[model samples]
Target: MEFNITESIQILTKTPSVISNLLKDLPETWIKTNEGVDTWSPYDVVGHLIHGEKTDWIPRALIILGENEDKAFVPFDRFAQLKNSSSRTLKQLLAEFEELRTENIQKLQALSIDEQTLERKGIHPEFGEVTLKQLLATWVVHDLGHINQITRVMAKNYKIEVGPWTKYLAILRDKK
Candidate 1:
């Protein structure tokens, strides 16, 4: 499919509501449960998304647009959410994420991104040079990836209970 910025923003805008619809009011046990060691819970996933909204996406875009290609993006702290979210409740995190995402999308629209700007390059700490289009596309996919991750982690809570039906469940079988 062609990358439509409007469509991408629409998808991005819906993520918080989608997550809230799926997870809100669930028992703490479900929210906190992980498939196993080294995995994140649904709450943790929300926190991570919050961290990305605050640190990763727009900041990197600004770096690219500011013509700072010589300056590589700071390596994202994948686990920063653990420390940052310790005090916040799930509701608080969700609200914060929604608000930040709204603000970031507004900022993105204000940039007046076009074909030329989308082709602008930025230096990634590890990936070397990358286009603005690639970076923006990654932002969308990152959200989808975590959404899938959260769903799989939540579903695995019923992995053994599903018993014979496990054969039909790809989420339980996939070891990410």
Candidate 2:
């Protein structure tokens, strides 16, 4: 989906509730882990998710707002340090996620329609010329991808034993 500021804010706000509903009673420990695909347990997923919330979307929003995106922006690999900096509890990460999402929505909503379309440039060492709009779309897609990954990990962790209905049910979890 194209990432208009309004639609993206909706996606960001809705995700936490969706996660909460799906993971009902599944303890924060289970929701956050270090034992799933790519060695990124549930906890790592939260860490990554929060990191994306803080560093990715919000910074882009700032850039779009004509503020300095540089101070908050970091190189890709350096961002991983956030998880290590704290004991990195799941609750803490979740809290950060909520705060970041709210901030992003507020900042984005404050912007004029023209501001949303304004180009804020970033030079990634790998992908050159990253723009504010592209980052916003990436943020939405990134969250969706992780939600998919989280559910998949949960299914495996709990051994839900999916059947044909599993595929159909999965669709209910995501719009696409």
How do all models score by TM-score?
0.96, 0.71
lDDT of 2: 0.63
The root-mean-square deviation over C-alpha atoms between each candidate and the true structure, in angstroms, is: 1.1, 4.8
lDDT of predicted model 1: 0.91
Alpha-carbon shift of residue 41 in model 2 (angstroms)? 2.4
lDDT of 2 by residue, 1-176 (tens): 44567777788788776665565466766765444344555556667766766666666556545655453345555348344635855566666766777776777777664553546576555676777777777877887887877766665543345555556665434322
1-176, model 1: which lDDT tens digit per residue? 87778889998999999999888989999899987888899999999999999889999899889954365787899999999998988999999999999999999999999999999888888899988899889889999998999999899889999999999999999996
- Please give the distance, in angstroms, between residue 121's alpha carbon in candidate 2 and its true position after superposition: 3.0
Candidate 1 wrong stretches, greater than 4 Å: 67-69
Q: Please report how far candidate 1 places residue 109 from its true position, in Å.
A: 0.6
lDDT of 1 at 23: 87
Compared with the true structure, all predictions reach lDDT values of 0.91, 0.63
Candidate no. 1 TM-score: 0.96
